[model samples]
Target chain A: MLIELQGIVKDYRLGLEIVHALNGIDIRIDQNEYVAIMGPSGSGKSTLMNLIGCLDTPTEGTYFLNGSNVSHMDDDQLAEIRNREIGFVFQNFNLLPRASALHNVELPLIYNGTPASQRRDLAEEALIKVGLKDRMGHRPNELSGGQRQRVAVARALVNKPSIILADEPTGNLDTRTGDEIMDLFEDLHDGGNTIILVTHEEYIAEHSDRIIRLRDGRVERDESN
Target chain B: MQFRESVFIALDVIRNHKMRSFLTLLGVIIGVMSIIGMQSLIEGFQKNIRHQMEQLGASVFQVQKFPVQFGQQDREKYRNRKDLTWDHARVIEQYCTAVAQVGPEAWQWGIMAKYRDRRTGPANHLAGGVPAFFPNNGYFIEAGRALSDTDIQHNRQVAVIGQDILEKLFPYENPIGEHIIVDGRRYQVIGTLEKSGSAFGESQDNRIVIPLSTFLKFYGQNRSLNITVLAASPELMDTAIEQVIGVLRAVRKVPPGEPNDFEIFSSESLIETFDNMTRAVRIGAIVIVSFALLVAGIGIMNIMLVSIRERKREIGIRMAIGARRRDILFQFLVEAVFLSEIGGILGILAGVGIGQLVALVSPVPASIPVFTIVLGFVFCSLVGLVFGVYPAAKASGLDPIESLRYE
Candidate 1:
């Protein structure tokens, strides 16, 4: 098992009321497994994704990532975990607008204190893996929706992290570009990379090796595809 | 993140907002400029005073009936005292064991000199002293000899003209052995002095030297005399001064346990007085300039806050990619420091230019040492750091999830 979540719970305060963003939940994901978390709006999927990404600590739960307890880690310790272990791809692409594609891919390596000489080679290889070798010098604004997402994907892979966590990776693209991105993720999964995705589309869930559905801040169903 | 990456990010932001960066840097620029400019002028003034004092001989002191002053009340206080005279100088030289030599000088300012068909205006100084006056006061003969002991003993009407007098009275010919009319009386010019440049815009070589006897005859015996005494060595200066005071008290018949009426001044005292006067002005200038820098620092803080707010989403993205809190802080701090340093460098250049301009047009001398430039840079950068901390901390303390969601 690469990730294990036990009895996770998250709470929020809204003025005079306490809201439960995530109710009790348990999950286990094995190495190289492709999983998609499905939910509608206000179904706690975002909160769960935030927890899995090590971005937020659970109020009452224990999270074991690669056999290390991470739910109680501090901000800097979590940042180190994020740098060395997790790669995130956002729905909006989250590419630095002014940076060239190559520089964007090199961001994760820079944060990890990689030497400048080696960072170039690793970033270039990641770009080439995502079919962005020729367009590495272009800025995000100059690239199309799919190309920008590919650049973001390359940035995520440059660190060779344990798992790739992409939140609504195809939310901003048309159907054609969306299918292309899903095909790219399929290719990455076939290459033996662990991938966890969050989405609301049933068709997207069908492509994953396993599916977990959330409703009212609790898991409604979990099944292998 | 690495320091180099932080610098690169800072440079990128500055390049993106050219006008904003310039506006933020203006205060630092003006503050540093004034500091360097004022320092240069003050240094120049002190140097000029030190040079004049050096010319007057480092180990010498002056004794007169009254202190150097301009107030009417001071003049009235010294009016009843007996004038310092050549006889008093003689008494000190004879009795003071620590004294090396004593030279008595009597001065008449604004005297005119005429040679042949040419004449100078009433801007000349007519001084009467013995042979030791030339060497003791750092004046050297450029042409002929100086006043001799025989000239003073016999009261000869011979003079050694300064370079200004020589140039004005005998521009095309040698002044030695010529007869010059000074204040309607003819005196034989025995020599011409080498040129000694001006200080504080006052020409040093605009005078003629004549014998004490001849000066007494021409300018009257009622004039007070100032005695210049050189010590045997610098270490014996205090002893020499005390011995001269003792001899003067006995010769003038002053009663025991009474205060001496004469005032003795040395180059050290004069320099101390100059420093005291300039110190107050220096403090005032620094206080005023610091307020300007304060305003500049505030301006930098304001802009940095705006920059942080504007780039909230960017900060979130960086944090999501593994940028720690200190990394964010370091990046913003570097940006602010870079802005201030740029302003400081420009200020140094402008300050040196302004200092040189003032020197050219006025009496103040200007010198820009390397220390002032370094000080300007260091001070402004400190200002940047101090003011930058608050904004950088604010940026670094933001919640990563919130910042990423900022519109």
Candidate 2:
């Protein structure tokens, strides 16, 4: 098992009121699993994704990532885990708008304290993986949305994290562009990388190897394709 | 984060908003400029005043009945002093071994001295003193000879003319043997003084000197005689003054432990009193200027917070991509310090320019203090750090997920 959650509960205080964002969640995933977390607005699916990526800690219960207790780590330790073990891709691509594609791809390696010479080599190889070897010097603003997402994917894979966590990764693209992104993720999965995605569209969820449906901050159904 | 990466972020931000950075730095520039400029002018004033005080001589102290008024005073009140006598001055010189020389001076109240009917007085006064008078009291003869004991005892009516008196009385003629009329009394001009300039912080080269006996005969014992004593060395000046007081006590037969009715003053004491007065003024100026600096610091803090707020999504992306919380904090902090340091450097340079300008226009030359230069930059950096803390913390403390979701 690569990730395990034992009845994790997350509560939010919204100005004098307790709003339960995630109530008692239990789930498990093994290596190379392609899982899609599907839900409506306010379903707490995004919250679960954030927890899985270690961007946040659970308010209660325990989460185990690679047999290490994820819920007990301090912010710096969590940050270190996120930098070297988890890669994130967002709907907006979230590439530094002013940064060249090469620098954007170099972000993960830079935070991992990689030496400059190795940083350049790995960042270039990652960009080549996304088919953007020639667009390395172009800033996000100068690139097409598809090109920007490719740059973001390169950035996500640069550190070769244990799992790739993407939130609404294709929500901003056209159908054809979204298909291209899905095809890229399919290739990453075939290469033995575990990928977890959060999305609202069933068509996007249908393409994953496994589907985890969430409703009202609880897991409604978990099934393997 | 590596310092190299943090600096890159700072440099990019500065380059992206060049106009805003310059505008923000303007307040700092003016603030530093004013502080350094004012301090330099004050520093220059201190040096100039100190030099003038030193020219008053190392060992001389003067005794006067009342404070020496720089402005005009009523002649009636000045002539009413009956306590200070020439007898006291002579006895002090005769009995006090610590006193190297004691000279007494008495001057005509309002005499217009003249030569060849080109009259010059109403503005001029006639003073009389002993011969050790010249050097001990900060005077030097330009030509001819000073007064001798023969002139005082026989009332020979010999005179020594100062620079102004020499100019007024003789004009183009040699004043050594000339006779100048003082208060309608004819006296042979035996000596002319070199331009002694402003000694004891006053123009001393503008008065006339005659024999003390000649002065007493004309003006009587009504005017207070000013007694000046020179100690053997500057270190012993205090001891010399105590010894003079003892002699004066015995000479006047005053009761022991009784406060002397006369006052003694030296260049050091006079300067201390002057500095005390200006200290209050300098403190007040500093207080007023601090208010401007406070406003400038607030401007820096407020803008930094605004910058951090606008860059929330950028910060989240950086963190998600791999930047640690400290990396985010370091980047913002370095940016703020860089802004303030640049401002401080420019301000200090501006201040030096203003200081030089003031020095050129002022009565004295400017002597800038090095401590102010170092202090100005250090103070500005401190301002950056103190004010930069909250915003940098805000940048670091941001929740990555929510920050990414923020519109």
Error of 2 at B3 (Å): 4.3
Candidate-wise lDDT, in order: 0.90, 0.84
Q: List DockQ, one per candidate, in order.
A: 0.68, 0.61
How many residue pairs clash in all the candidates, one count each? Answer: 0, 1
| Candidate 2 Cα misplacement greater than 4 A, ranges | A13-26, A32-34, A96-144, A174-192, A201-211, A218-225, B1-34, B67-85, B106-129, B141-222, B250-255, B286-296, B322-343
In candidate 1 chain A, what residue range of length 10 has the lowest lDDT sum?
A77-86
> What lDDT tens digits, residue by residue, belong to model 1 across residues A76-173?
98888888888899999998898999999999898889999999999999999999889999999999999999999999898988899999999999
lDDT of 1 by residue, B1-407 (tens): 58888888888988999899888888998998998899898888888989898888767998988876547867887887889999999998888888898899999999999988898888889999998788667789998899999999999999998888887888788778889998888899999898998887788899899998999987899978999999888888999999999999888888999888788888888888788778888889889988999999999999999999999999998898898888889989998888888889989999999999999998678998578789778989999899999999999999988988888
lDDT of 2 by residue, A164-207 (tens): 99898899999999999999999999999999999999999988
